[model samples]
Target: MLPALLRRLPRRHRASFFRRRMGAPGDLRRFLAIIMMIGCVFLLYMFWAQPTSPTSVPLQTFVPVVTSKDSNTHYAKIDFRWTWTCENKRCVRKESTETGVHVSLTTCSMLCGSSMLWPQPTGPTTLGSHSVSFDREQLTFETTATEPARSYIQYSFAMFNSNVANLIQLQKNEPSATPQRDFNKFIVKVFVEHSDIVKLTLSTDESYKLILRMEGENMIGTVTANNFFGARHGLETLSQLIWWDEFASGAGSLKIVKGASVQDAPKFAYRGLMIDTARNFLPVESLKRVLVGMAANKLNVFHWHVSDSQSFPLVLPSVPQLAKYGSYSPDMVYTASEVKDLVEYARLRGIRVVIEVDVPAHVGNGWTWGPAEGLGELVMCVNVQPWSLYCGEPPCGQINPDNPHVYDVLEKIYRDIIELTGESEIFHIGGDEVNLECWQQFRNRTNPYVDLFDVWGNFTVEALKRVTKANGGKRPKHVMIWSSNLTKRPYLTKFLNKTEVLIQAWGGSDWTETPELVSSGYNVIISHVDAWYLDCGYGRWRENGGAACDPYRPWQTVYMHRPWNGDPVYRKSVLGAEACLWTEQADHVSLDTRLWPRAAAFAERVWSDVGTKSIYKQEQLSIEDVYARIQMQRERMIKRGLKNEALWPQWCSQNPGMCL
Candidate 1:
């Protein structure tokens, strides 16, 4: 150290200093003193000039505190993305001064709060940067409506509070939060023009407009709709806009984007989800959960396909014998009172419960009691052998059109359905898979000259009349029938009334049935078997069973299908669509998994009525664009206790672009 210091010194100084160090003990002490003095000066210089240590913060780091004077200073007005400095894991929004990193409030919200929406609003919408936090317990509602519909609005407000679900924050302890700008009370109010509408039908106006803004220390929300259904939908959209912020103060701290407007309505009139509980019974609680899921997604029709060859679970008060002799067990039956309650439950959720008693074809076990009760051979070939030769699938059964008693029995079932649902505007007389051979073998023994197609077609005609009679001799304006051999070619127009029947095309999209039905002037609900069937591809439910519809339909297939495109008239004839969940491989156990997020995909399609090509080219949104949105939808469904299935890995969800 002394030599290095001497080398930097002037020539005369270096010589003088070295001369003093040359004398014995006294010289060494002088050298030591000189070294200590130089080292002290060097230490002091380093202390004054060394760099500052960075903070060990998790989310944000501390920046130089800008003084009060800086607030008055003028800076360049430029657009910059919102960034943050992590001061102990709190993502405090900051304005950057760097070249390109300077920025937006949306990004900061993405970190601390999420504003992602589902079934994306179909009309004009504006999202603002401001936010307000609310205490969930302090949420209240006010409205201008009469008794019938006001109750719906009140129930929906409570649902809105619960649906403001907490974002999943995976941590052991709560960290410090930036105290939010609080709203003293989150007051909501609604106005409905047609508050008398207690039932939601195809005619019900389900369009709504919502405006949210801050007022001094509180927030006021305004929802205007034509009916309670639309108002309820507005509330659902509002719920989507709010999320639980764990990083904010209070046990129930929730944040929402302030100063927003939305106008929304379904693009198609009948956005539906068909749950085939007949194949395998679903619990009432599970079905109610399904209703909640549908409400969240803005799906209107719940096509409850309650009967088939495998089981007769719905106990009709007119014919208790059917369920008595036919049900797998007594507890499995859906009682008349239960059906009434379910219908009411669905109605309150703004969903129409269209109970389907698929006649002539998907009727077997329930009809066996007919002959035992002295009705002549009601459904022949019940559980017939060499099943493929007689029916579409195993456990072969078909209602005997030859028996007058069969149609009489069907009339009672239809009457019960109409009574229970408290809905007679539309009926779903399911006419899916009809086995000709099942009836043909029985008919050959009686009268071989009868044409099978005419007989099948006639059954639908008679059933429609019976259901019409069931509705106090007034025909339902629309009757839904599943596309089958009878709905194809010459047979379609020959018997099925184009004015009254709606053919739900479940044939392959490439098959021309959807176009034919539309071209023939019959309205169609597009549930193309290849595209919209959710129950496909779980593998054979039985040994070498119904694999005809195998190869599972993923969410992508469900989202992009548009069978009635290219013509406005054709699109007009296209009523809407349904995602059918046949319970061959799904039941209460896997109900949520089989239908959800995928069904939600279908929900957006019918609601927005967007096409795959249009979304890709015109809108410039590929499948990747929808992945995150649907993921958020799935998360919301889970928070509401929906148990929705995830089609992506957890890692992929956290890191978005990397997965793509």
Candidate 2:
């Protein structure tokens, strides 16, 4: 009892007691030093000797193998051989023939095992630094996990239901050489006695140092997903979805808020948000992060504007030179496989990607190709010097829509695009701004220069449709054109009368100022440019003039804009909203700042049941809350190497997103 009290006493007081008892100064000093050293060693030993975990569960990346009685394989025999340095610690393994097989290895230094046909085998697998072997019909795996044991015995049930061909294919496509980089590291060990219905005793542990053991009738051992990083968050997000097949949590069984049956689907069948890679190209990794953000917001459509007048991003198989002339870099084109990878990644997150090759007007090839050059008959020389800007010479460039050969060129390009993007039902024939001046200058040489509508705009619609439909595939379902067409009257009637085209009503929607196109029985996407455009960087009131004053929109403006203002009955025309970032003068430096935090609001507006308000008034609400969230998001963007810092200004107006 006296020793225990002394041990419990404060160390300084104990030392004082020692000093007082020792009397001699030098002897007391030496004795105190020795006592202090001994105390430290004892503490360190106490920590080190506190029983290292007895079991080691190694992560193994396993391929599914199937065999049936019809194949005359004798119960698929398995042989396992394991070699480990036990280091004087007892290494023991328990195995069984019943309930398939169970094996557990116990040792202080290392626990290692090799076994055959264990644990209801048809299930998912995890990969790590493990070695597995199979010969004749015998199988073996040899590995040792850490002392605290952080690994899993992922049971594979699909093996029983697979054919020989599937087995062969699975074997061929084994988990990556490094499984830790692929599947997350996890472990579970369970001990049961006698009856399957009753759990007499159970034990569980994790790398996070969480451990539990119990004896009960019904038992469940679950590891809450770590809010860690990388593929783990992806796994966690997927686990929360309704359709996740593997490890899907049953209703009320998992830690979910009760009374909340979130039977929700996306509002629009197609929620499209475009990134203009043509004007200001972004690297693949940058685009991938954007894709992840898109997934988070439930925005399904990735309208990748891969090409335009500025440059092309697709590597044309038929016309490789086109990419050379159009791309920013010598080889700046997305390979076929890369496009497939993007598609598959998007598909996993319930997103569909649509590629847009804005043709005829936007692809100003004539500017670079020059006149007298045979570029789909689109370039024309104003004078003797064919390529000159003006030489008493002809201004020789601009696509001549009247030419028959022009249609043939487009047809070839369309075929190539189709092959690259798989099969998209809608093709955006960008008929936005053909500036009549381009046609008026080179008019007589191309077509019968008739009325304002018929000569330039009307002709291209029919010609483009003809060429697009000529391909063997199904005719594209829809074509997207700017709302500028409605302002251009009889020409609008020409295309509107022919096919069902969706008009993107993006001129700026106002409660008082009604749009002629929206009222004219047209299915309109209410993408008002003032509110939703993300490309217009912050600090634009000074740089680009006040009328073009596009200070980066904060959260409130995005969330509160009402789609249907006038009448609820007529609101079906309000298909959905799209947040576009037109890269007129955008780069990686300022893109993420303007688009994010601001875009997060638009996402909430579209996905959540957040109520609405007048666009002007919405800017007045306290957006500071959203700004805090934005700061967090901005930090993430920066960490991911996004150019978000360029968006921050040295000083900003207190009421941002408000019109002065």
**lDDT by residue (tens digit), candidate 2, 1-660:** 767878998987997876677888998789779989999999999999875331222222122233532342222112323222322222222233433222212111112111110110111212112221111111111112221111221111011111111211122222233111111211222221111111000011101111111224211122232211111112222222111011111100111111111112233344567788877777766677677666545565677777666576676665554566567785556776777778756654435566766644566431343233465445333222333332211222345666666665566667776666554455555555454555655556533446545655555566456536644645665556556643345566665643456666666666322255556666666667767777643543223234243665545676667666546533656556678876656665566665665665676565432344422233222343344234434433333334443334522211222222
Superposed on all Cα atoms, model 2 deviates from the true structure by an RMSD in Å of 21.5
TM-score of each: 0.81, 0.54
Q: For residues 1-660, what per-residue lDDT tens digits would candidate 1 score against the true structure?
A: 966887899997876666665777787788799989999999999999965432232333222222342243222222334455333322355555454342122234333322356787767767775566765655678998998998988988878876763442222223445445476777898999988887877767899999999888778888999999999999998887776553344212467777788888887889989998778889899999999999989999999988888888888999888887778888998988888889888887889999888877877887787657788888877898988787777788888887888888888888988888887887988887787877766764456777888888888889888988888999998888888889887998898889989888888889978888888999888888898899988888677555768788889888887666657987779888888888877888899899889999999888877553332234534555577678878878877877788877875664443476
Q: Which stretches of candidate 1 lie over 4 Å from their true place?
A: 1-115, 165-181, 250-252, 444-446, 611-622
- Shift in Å, residue 403, candidate 1: 0.9
How many steric overlaps are in each model, in order? Answer: 14, 11
